[model samples]
Target: MNIRFDLRQVRAFLAVASTLHFKQAAETLCITQPALSRLIKGLEESIGAELFTRTTRQVELTVAGRLFLGECQQAITHLERATHLAQQAASGDIGHLSIAYNDFSINGVLPSILDTFKEKYPDISVDLVYMPSHTQHKALLDHEIDVGFLIGPLDMAGIQTFRAALERIVVILPRRHHLADRQQLYIEDLKDEKFILGTENGWREFRQYIFNICIKAGFTPQVVQEASTSSGIFGLVAANMGVSLYSDCINRFQRDDIAVVPLDHDDYSVETIAAWSMSYTTPSFRLFRELLESRLGGES
Candidate 1:
């Protein structure tokens, strides 16, 4: 009589009462049948009432159980709404957003996106972190970053993504390089050249694209150096270390020593996407997305 009833017991009882079968209830509750039975027994004992009548084939809730189930349902719904409201309050429309972006995003796309977003929602704070595409994806999955701007398509579960822009990859080479004089270059033209590429395994798809294009052109590239940041890669190319491929946004660097040549192949285009967890999107997140879409001409 002195034992206090717990929410767990109420939830268990409600599950059983709704289904009218202990085995089915146990399955729904993700508990063993014996554990569910024991919980119901304890709940009944605490209330000094029998909640259900059970047979080998089926179970039926008693009058007291039906009434209790109704109350339990109401209580659970209220608790859920209250929890949601509290979360909303904590993440005000003017809350901090942890964002992960990469080199291509940092130069122009992100600045434009943020300029529009801040004008619309000046109270919202953004914490921008520059990371590789692979690192950004992992950070989003771990909840370390609230949103990510990177290349797609990411096939991770529980993450929702939308394409923000389609950019073409251009070849960046030393101004004096032979291909630098050409108005346009094809993947086959880069064969037998020493390349400066982003670190392998860090930007998986991008690195793969470079290798795939080279293989399709009948030779593996002799990579001269690998850099993690786009600036570093461009700097190396400017120093005549090796030619590299980069998105059109790289033109913002404007290094006199490096010349950018547009690629003529369809596979040379890249898609930038915005991604976030389905369970953690807030009003601020939606607003940020709206601002980005507006700035990007509603591409997403």
Candidate 2:
């Protein structure tokens, strides 16, 4: 037998099945009881089956009605899911977004990115992975992450990059240090200081920047310690472990025992970049990149 199914009939079936009363179902569906009764009668005739056993006092489902109700429930659930999926796809919210960035990005830029992205497309679920700059680059190469926020001069093949911002590196010192009283300090002033550096192996740009600045100022830094994160490095500095070079964002850590001093030299700045695998540059990723570029003042 050829049977036609309409969404309206499915909706009417679900409403009547749930309420077990034509008057109640009509009220829920915002239609009159007579109109609802007509719809249900047409639906039952279309399927060539009796869906309800009605009496003067009460109405109940027949065996066929019970089975049809189950099918109607499943159909309604699938329809709702389909509608949600369609809406998500229309608004660029259905796909997976794998983002990799260093810990500094989380403190400095991620909050704004998340806020804007959520406001624009609240259904797009994002997976954020934090790694050192080198590891983020490697993950992008491996196609494990869709986008990367890295501190550069990155020279990697098969990756497309756009420079975002140039962030000035600052010296983090114990609040009681004598140099902390100065508004700014030159690299030469820190020549004899025992320096704490973060991520010696993975943060090539920052690690090299620190070493080169110290060498240009006429002495090798006396290395006192190494840490893998901004918080750890700043925590060590706060405890007076040693002075450390860090980005301006580290000041937001708000540790009472630590103070930030600006570097007097211009070359100590690090450039942040947005990078992605050349192969996975979809329109959605491009739009996201544009959003980031706008935030960084690099949008064309």
Candidate 3:
């Protein structure tokens, strides 16, 4: 038994074991009858057992061959499954994606887009991380997150950005406030009001944009209070801790005490974009990009 057994020999054995006919097995294996006989002989010689019993008219597996057949079937099935899984992974049909998002994104178009993605690519598992825009931006650079739903241009080094959506910044005002019923609130109108601004460590681009809007209106906002949470911000606004600016989609958090009113200026909007570190462009990333493009259509 110095001869070695290989996959082709096992395959030849399985074919012969299955049909129990040398001529038919040779046809199935696309080999000559003599060649098939040689392979089965080699395999039986290596195993030191007679795998088949033959009369001129019929062939049959011995007890040993029957047991070996079960094991061979399992081995072939497992090998086929491994090959399939590898192919699926390479095609980005099966894998894990680490995604980061802020409050604005999860509340707005992100949910619908995610639903569509799930329908198409069910095998791709998503790891959803919640963080503010600044943190998400930093995480993308550090390779902690594969994709980020963030605000602003995010024109930082090594980051590729795709603007996903643009939503107007709306005012979150106490319902009883005089300006709440107005058709639209101008940035100038809130100059004297004690504004509830975002904390310094939060959305940097958005905070600066709001400041620029206030500066254009001839006065800086008076920051009376600060909170990092969206629900907390809404609570603050409901309490009249002062009105604040938020993307219009967050009006879903509207309350009896707080009113959502749009800004008068057309430029007063926030850009929700997708960002990734340059190295993270994989098939999973392309699937996510396609989902956004499908939903927004020319907007992404």
| lDDT by residue for model 3 (1-300), tens | 454799999999999888889999999999999999999999999898999999999999999989989888877865764575578679976765778988788988688788888888888878898888988876886567779998867778888887788899999898888898998988888988988867777656677888988898899988889887778888899898899999999766547889888998778889888888886465677888777776676432
Candidate order, lDDT descending:
3, 1, 2
| lDDT (Cα atoms) of all candidates against the true structure | 0.82, 0.79, 0.83
lDDT of 1 at 152: 81
For 179-244, candidate 1 gives per-residue lDDT tens digits of 898999988888878899888655667888778888988989889899987878888998899998
User: Model 2 RMSD to the real structure?
Assistant: 14.5
1 or 3, which is superior by lDDT?
Answer: 3
Error of 1 at 14 (Å): 30
Q: Model 2, residue 159: what's the lDDT? A: 85
Show model 1 residue runs off by greater than 4 Å. 1-93, 297-300
Worst 10 residues of 1 by lDDT: 291-300
| TM-score of model 3 (CA atoms) | 0.66
For model 1, how big is the CA root-mean-square deviation?
10.5
* True lDDT of residue 69, candidate 3: 92
Error of 2 at 41 (Å): 63
Scored by lDDT, model 2 comes in at: 0.79
